[model samples]
Structures are given as structure tokens and as C-alpha cells.
Target: MDVKRISGLGRNAAGDLAKGVRQVGPGGQVIVVRPANSNFTLQEYQNFVNNFKPQQPGVTFRVVDEAALPK
Candidate 1:
């Protein structure tokens, strides 16, 4: 499976999400990497989903905490 990895979503989370959707298209997986104490919030994450759902249906989106990942 192809994964579209996005790291460090500071102020441009939405834009990055759009890019990911475009890159992966439909039926693709998106892995978002953010810090445990990141500025990104769940509301924003949901907004990304709500905005892109119509354009890219059946896309899987997952957010991963960089600080929690095992090395």
C-alpha cells in the first residue's frame, strides 16, 4: 500500500491535506505525523476530512504522534 506521509503540520495543515488528497487520489492511505504537543487540533483534522470527503471519497487518513512512535 502506498502511504502519503506528512510531517510537521504547523499553520498549513489544511493545504497539506489537500495536497495529500490530490497526490493519493481515491482509495489511498494518508499518514499524518505530528508532535504530541502539536498546535494541530482534532477540530482542524476533522475539518480536513469534511472538506476533502466530497472530492476524495474512500481515502483513509491516520494521524500519528511523532513523539509516541517507537524508534
Candidate 2:
């Protein structure tokens, strides 16, 4: 399956999510990676989904929470 990987949390994570949706379209899956204590809000993540358009039937988003990733 074609997958879009988003690394980081909060604003950074959302940015990646937006990029994924834009580049991969609504037919692919999105993977968001984030730190444990980035103090990010769920709304940030939802914001990405809200802006995503042309929803495809098989489209999906997967978030990976991983801290200590190199910036």
C-alpha cells in the first residue's frame, strides 16, 4: 500500500500531515510520527483531516508516537 509518513508532533506533525494529503492524495495512507511530550493538541491533528479534500474510500491516517527523533 502506498503510505505517507509524517514525523514529529504539534505544528510540525500537522505540516507533515498536510503535505502527505497533498502529495499522496486521498487514495493513500498517512503515518504521523510524534514525540511523547511535544504538548501537541488533538485539534492540531484534526485540523489536517478537516482540510483534506476529495476523500477516497481507502484513504487512512496512522500516527506513530516516537520521541528522541532527530530534528
Query: Which candidate's lDDT is highest?
Result: 1
| lDDT of predicted model 1 | 0.61
Model 1 earns a TM-score of 0.60
Could you give candidate 2's per-residue lDDT for residues 1-32 as a string of tens digits? 33444433446555556666666665777765
Q: Please tell me which predicted candidate would have the highest TM-score against the true structure.
A: 1
Q: Provide the TM-score for each candidate, comma-separated.
A: 0.60, 0.45
Residue 38's C-alpha lDDT in candidate 1?
Answer: 52
- Expressed as tens digits, the lDDT of each residue in 4-68 for candidate 1 is 34444444666677677778889877776655565666556545545554257777777655676
Q: Candidate 1's error at 50, in angstroms?
A: 6.5
In angstroms, give how far residue 60 of model 2 lies from its true place: 1.0
Q: Which stretches of model 2 miss by more than 4 angstroms? A: 1-13, 41-58, 67-71
lDDT of every predicted structure (CA atoms):
0.61, 0.54
